[model samples]
Target: MAEVPIVVHPAIEQGGRAVVVRNEVAGLAHCDREVVEFLRRVGLPLSDDILDDPVWVEWRGGRAHDYEAA
Candidate 1:
């Protein structure tokens, strides 16, 4: 299968994570719901468990619920 284009970058200052899609910045998501929203905004098909779906999202520098830098 193809690599997922959506990546939830590490949370940084401003307490948000940078959501990237296809090498472009989609938006900063602060929570799981927001991440889902961003994906929807980009017209991507995602399940309710998107945060846990490795095939759909690649989480880096933190876990799915990590919204702050460690």
Candidate 2:
């Protein structure tokens, strides 16, 4: 199988090391409404907005492999 491309959010660094890394879906869905609207206007799936909340970070982390397999 071909390796899927993953889009990680620009890392959030603390003390010069990355402390947070979220998938593009989670990052974009959590971004400003205008950005979400633009993505929606472009016909991208919006069903994953549930990934936006910080509470879902661990869940999203676990799912990173799924993205990588996409």
Find the candidate with the highest lDDT and give its number.
Answer: 1
Residue-pair clashes per prediction, in order, are 0, 0
Candidate 2 lDDT over residue span 1-70, tens digit each: 4322223233232211111233234233333353345445545555455235433323223232133221
Residue-level lDDT tens digits of model 1 in 1-70: 8978889999997798999987889898888888888888889887868778788789999777789877
* Cα shift from native, residue 58, model 2 (Å): 16
CA lDDT of every candidate: 0.85, 0.34
Cα RMSD of predicted structure 2: 10.3
**Candidate 1: stretches off by over 4 Å:** none
TM-scores of the models, in the order given: 0.86, 0.26
Candidate 1 local distance difference test against the native: 0.85
